[model samples]
Target: MIKIHLSRLLGERRLTQADLARKTGIRPSTIGDYYHELAERINLDHLDLICEVLNCTVSDVLEYIPSHKRKK
Candidate 1:
C-alpha cells in the first residue's frame, strides 16, 4: 500500500495541518484528508507544493510497501 507520512513528518517538524495548508496553499480539508490517510487520490500539483513547503522529497512524503498478495 502507498502510505503517506504527512502526520509523522508534521509531528517531527513540530507543524500543524493548518500550518502546512497555509504554507502550501493547499486546502485545509485536503491536507487533513492526507494527514489522516483518508485520501483516495492525490493531486501532483498539491504534492509539489507540499514538498516545496516541507523541504522534502516525494519519497519522504510517501512510501510503498508490498501488500501480502504482492509480496514475493
Candidate 2:
C-alpha cells in the first residue's frame, strides 16, 4: 500500500487543510481529500507544490510498502 503521511506532517507543522490549500493554491477540497488519505490518485504538479510548501521531500509525505512486506 502507498501510505500518505500528510496528516502526520500537517500535525507536526501545526498546519490545517485550509492553511495548506492557501499556501499551495490547491483547492481546499483536494487538500482535504489528501489530508484524510481519501485520494486515490495525485498529480505530480500538485505534489510538487505541496512539497515546496511543506519544505519536505516526496518521501517525507509518502511511503510505499509492498503487500508481502506488510505485517499481517
Candidate 3:
C-alpha cells in the first residue's frame, strides 16, 4: 500500500487544505483528494508544488508499504 502523510503533516503545521491550496496555487479539490488518499493517480508536478509549500521531501509525503498476501 502507498501511504500518504499529507494529513499528518498538515496537522503538525496546523494548516488547512485551503491554506495549502492558496500557497501552492493548487486546486483545493486535488489537495483534498490527496489528504483523503482518494486520488487514483498523482501528478508529479503537483507533488513538487506540495512539497515546496510543506517544506517536505517526497519521501516525507509518500511511503511504500508492502502488503501481506494470504497463504493457501
Candidate lDDT (C-alpha), each = 0.94, 0.93, 0.91
> Global CA lDDT of candidate 1, please?
0.94
Check candidate 2 and list the clashing pairs.
Answer: none
- Output the worst ten-in-a-row residue range by lDDT, candidate 2: 63-72
Candidate 2 C-alpha lDDT tens digits along 25-71 = 99999988888899999889999999999999999989999999897
Question: What lDDT score goes with residue 13 in model 3?
Answer: 93
Number of the top-ranking candidate, with lDDT as the measure: 1
Candidate 2 local lDDT, residue 10: 94
Record all residue pairs in model 1 with backbone atoms less than 3 Å apart, i.e. clashing: none
Sort by lDDT, top down from the best: 1, 2, 3
Quote model 2's TM-score: 0.94
Instruction: Score residue 35 of candidate 3 by CA lDDT.
Output: 98
Q: Candidate 1 — worst ten consecutive residues by lDDT sum?
A: 63-72
Rank the candidate models, highest TM-score first. 2, 1, 3
Residue-wise C-alpha lDDT for candidate 1, range 1-72, written one tens digit per residue: 899999999998999999999999899999999999999899999999989988999999998887984676
lDDT of 2 at 34: 89
